[model samples]
Target: MKVYSYSFKEGDLIPTQYTCDGLDISPHISWSKVENAKSYAIIMDDPDAPIGTFTHWIVYDIPSNVLELKENFPKKSVVGNIMQGQNDFGKIGYGGPCPPRGKPHRYFFKVFALDVESLGLPAGLSREEVERFINKHTISSGFTYGLYKR
Candidate 1:
């Protein structure tokens, strides 16, 4: 799969709205050329954290045809086209970066194209576990990176 977005260009700044400086919502994401994908999954995390990898967002079971997730989605209601899993914050949905103040950190936003509609994994999984699960099930995948600093 090839992942792209309307919010920002690949390798460009992800915008303050998706960070601690703004609304802290998820930006729109899109992908194409996914092979035999029944659903899509998105995982946003910061590997540069001082302690370990930190998950910023977790979403899955997104209908393959359904592209583009609006900013700040699922804030008060289900967006109807997808389901969200818990992030490192132990909450369901998007959680923007709040890295310890200091130098800049890199956040990876990855998209996975899966052959199955559901991975059948339970919610509230850690970023490490989720990465392992996606590796086992992904048919195609792509990613974008953004940097933020205090």
Candidate 2:
């Protein structure tokens, strides 16, 4: 599987509209389908955070047939069958990059193909909690990254 985004190119600078400096909305993202995938999940984070890796978004229970998450995805706990988890910002749904001044930070958007349809987890769970469940069921994964700075 390969993850990608129309909001920005892989390893390119993310546009201001998707960061704290602007709208702070979730960027449009998509991924290639993986064989035998019962469901898919996404975890976006900035490893360059001052306090270690900081999760910007956690989305799971996405239907296997779905291929993309549109721009400015609603900040909801549960939408239809998909679940959005709480980010390091203590908010539910996407939290755009807001790194401190200086060097640009790399935000990684990772997509996982799960063996199960759902992790049976509720929304609003922390990244750590959700990741624990994802790790157990993940079959294949791919990622893309964008750089951002204040």
Candidate 3:
């Protein structure tokens, strides 16, 4: 599988509209379909965070037929069948990059093609919890990233 973003190219600087300095909304993201994939999950984080890897977004139980998540996705716990998990910021849905000034931080958006239609997890779970379930069912995965700085 291959993950990509229309908002920003791989290794490119993310626009301000998607960061804490701007609207702080989720950027539009898409991925290639994987054979035998029953569902998909996305985990976006900043490994350059001062507090270690910080999760910005967690989305799971996305229907396999769905290919992209639109920009500025709602901050609700549940949006249709997709479930949004809590980020390190203690908020649900996307939390745009807000890294401290100095070096730019890389924000990775990882997508997982899963064998199961759902992880059977509830909304508002932590990234660790969501990842644990994703790891067990993932059949294929890919990632794309963008850089940002305060």
- Measured against the true structure, the TM-scores of the candidates, in listed sequence, are 0.86, 0.99, 0.98
Cα lDDT tens digits for candidate 3, 1-150: 889999999999999999989999999999999999999999999998888999999999999999999999999999999999999989999999999999999999999999999999999999989999999999999999999977
lDDT of each residue in 16-109, candidate 2, tens digit only: 9999899999999999999999999999999999899999999999999999999999999998999999999999999999999999999999
Q: Of the candidates numbered 1 and 3, which has the greater lDDT value?
A: 3
Clashing pairs in 2: none
Error of 2 at 22 (Å): 0.4
Instruction: Report lDDT per candidate.
Output: 0.77, 0.96, 0.95
Q: Residue 122 deviation, candidate 3, in Å? A: 0.7
* Cα-based lDDT at residue 73, candidate 1: 77
Model 3 TM-score relative to the real fold:
0.98
List the candidate numbers ranked by lDDT, top first: 2, 3, 1
Using TM-score as the yardstick, the better of models 1 and 2 is 2
Score candidate 2 by TM-score against the native.
0.99
Cα TM-score of candidate 1: 0.86
Off by over 4 Å in 1: 76-78, 121-132
Model 1 worst lDDT run, 10 consecutive residues: 75-84
Give lDDT tens digits, candidate 1, residues 28-99: 777775768888888988999987888888887778787667667774213564667778778888888788
